[model samples]
Target: MSSLDKRGLKERLTAGENVLVAEGYLFEFERRGYLKAGAFVPEVVLKHPDLVRSLHEEFVHAGSDVVLAFTYYGHREKMRLIGKEDLLEPLNVGALRIAREVADKTGTLMAGNICNTTIFQRGDKEAVAKTRAMFKEQIEWAVQEGADFIVAETFSELGEAKVALEAIKEYGKGLPAVVTLAPQATDKTYDGVPMGEACRQLEEGGADVVGLNCHRGPKTILPLMTEVRRACKGPIACLPVPYRTFEECATMQSLKDPITGRREFPVDLPAHLCSRTEIGEFARACRAMGVQYAGLCCGNSSHFMRVLAEGYGRSPPSSKYSPDMSQHYVFGSDPSFKKYYQEGLIETVSLNNKV
Candidate 1:
């Protein structure tokens, strides 16, 4: 399929099509040497370019329609911690180079991605200005490198998302922008803003697509997307964390005790990771609700992207999967009826003959 431009992308989503974007760079970032979120910015871009390229290739092969550059933490604050503060431009450029190469090779859209730097406070003029400057710098590099869109994601506050979108408009040079928050099942950002209000504010702030990503599974976030759809008029996207037991933990970030606030890590989180069937099923649900962008956030592997694409890309009335028939076949269609009816007849005849 041909890649869509900004208007084309929005149009396709309006038509109930899934714009599958690969958003879980943290998974591969850990697989390399960067064990934590803070260490990934410099290491992945400067020390290990090969791993980034390989991951991008894997994402494209796994059916990602859009490949976001590994700019998730490419800001100066994150880099200054490692004394690679001067390498800010290099890191952002290097990461985008790898993503651009793979995207160009595979014919996928390349998105410039940035996330929140700190907890957002609305009245903090200095902090907001600084954050916007950081975003502007990143957006400049992304635009210079020929990115198709800019995604300001994983914000805990609505104000940060609004700042990112404004920065995109200032430096993105007319590229489409996507702003996604990290919301909980309570329909609120970790910073205490309502999710619907978040989407509405971003839509008013000039975001082309407004939605949420990470911190929970599709099962938990599906209902929340309804509120997002109501607030966001253009296009809505949801990329839940690839976790399973949403009942136990509504979001990966809140893996702490509710009362004690004790956190757990390296503590058998696989139980929270969704199976391939679960991810695909989530994608199917997104399509039904008119969600144009179906993506993943944390714990996302290539297999997860593949499954999501397969499920969301299926034609209407045939999106469900069944072991007895091809996934492309519609449920309860003539072919399915014949297959089951013939099997039933054969079983009845065999039983009667044996008796």
Candidate 2:
């Protein structure tokens, strides 16, 4: 069995291997009430290092190939929101330390994670710079603390993603950067960029791996991955939010304004999420469609990650045609059934049974 290491993950994929990447600790912690809102990084690492390591170990026990640090939104800016800005360095750096502990234990690759600086100003250079700074600090800490790769995820716009990619290149120094976007269920980003076009832009911006994550469930994102598989040349990842199918919610959020094109709150979301078997099926289908990195987004659980890991790279079960279905043609059960006849069956008139 080949142990996981992020630095060589792309090479392995290029050599025709399907890698299983699992990321889900924050939501798990939150669901358990160990983590309050806006304090995942600090609470998990500083206060409850055992919980962080325990979650990582759960993924390892379940067969995840990567230990993505629960450093999502661990920058100083987000810390300031919850009045924990003073804990920024300890939170960010300490998260990486916790990640390393797990990666070392399980021999999994540690992926440095950063997402959504909350500065999505497209044309404003100052705003973009601030976003870069936010990512830069986290990327620097991850690199210094020895992460194998970087994942910039849940981005809703190409412009903000570009800024993140630039920071990864600047600070990570050749570490593979996987940029994942959160497009609406309509297959376009909330900022109005088509999913395919956004993947292309991230590729051009120097992201080593490009794919979709968060927002939509795997069932709804399947067609979107099919669309992206055409535009993206090499390996791609597809880690969807662990929600039930998007049939309940047409999109991840409410309608956007006609003028500003924004929906502040997500009014529609599934009360229950996908089952372990369904997530496994999702991983299987993504592998068939050429998605190399298969994982879960928010609401991720150890059981679901195990489902994905169990099915990664395995061929889906061959389709079956029901024997009864074939009998329909011969027995004249089908209105247009004319291909064959059943020897013992009688095709008769209604009154006299004359055929």
Q: Name the top TM-score candidate.
A: 1
For candidate 1, the per-residue lDDT at 97 reads 87
Best by lDDT: 1
**Candidate 2 regions off by >4 Å?**
1-7, 38-42, 251-270, 313-355
Q: What digit string (tens of lDDT, one per residue) describes model 2 on residues 150-234?
A: 9999888877888889899989978999998887756787678889889988998888889888777777888888878888987
Residue 27 miss distance in model 2 (angstroms) = 1.2
- lDDT by residue (185-233, candidate 1, tens digit) is 4678756878988898888888889898877777788878899888777
- Going through the candidates in the order shown, the clash numbers are 2, 0
Q: What is the lDDT of residue 29 in candidate 1?
A: 70
> Model 1 — which ten-residue stretch has the worst lDDT?
314-323
Task: Please give the CA lDDT of all the candidate structures.
Answer: 0.77, 0.76
RMSD of each: 7.1, 9.9
